[model samples]
Target: MIRLLEEMEQERRRMNELGQALLEQSIPLSEHDELLALSQKVDQLMMQLHYAKVEQTERQYVRGGTNFEAPSMV
Candidate 1:
């Protein structure tokens, strides 16, 4: 989890650098091909982190026994 978070942070920093570069070059962000690719990668990492957290929660619940239920939002 720590490793994934670190990697995600690194990717975000890279994306920021790319965005700055595009702005400096007067290139439209939407038209930057590499930015689009990097954005997709960051999104994937976010999803991975989300799923990992969910899985960890489920594991904790299982370990706590079958009667454990997640709290309702409402």
Candidate 2:
């Protein structure tokens, strides 16, 4: 669980770096294509982070046994 969260965080940091670089640099069209790929990677990382959170929640509930229940939004 910790490891997954760490990986997610690392990816997020990398994504942010790429985004800032894209904004600050005035590169060629070919380089923009590469930056676009990094943007897609960011999307994929976000999905991974979401799923990891869900799985971690489930694991926590299971470990807590019958005492656990999903929280009410209200």
| Candidate 2: worst-modelled 10 consecutive residues by lDDT | 26-35
Which candidate number would show the highest TM-score if scored against the true structure? Answer: 1
lDDT accuracy of residue 15 in candidate 2? 62
Query: Model 2 RMSD to the real structure?
Result: 4.6
Candidate 2 has which clashing residue pairs, if any?
Answer: none
Candidate 2 lDDT: 0.69
Which pairs, if any, clash in model 1? none
Kindly list the per-residue Cα lDDT of model 2 for residues 5-68, writing each as its tens digit: 6766776687677667766775443466665775676677667778987887888788884455
List model 1 lDDT by residue over 34-72, tens digit each.
Answer: 999999999999999999988998987879844566988
Global lDDT of each candidate: 0.91, 0.69
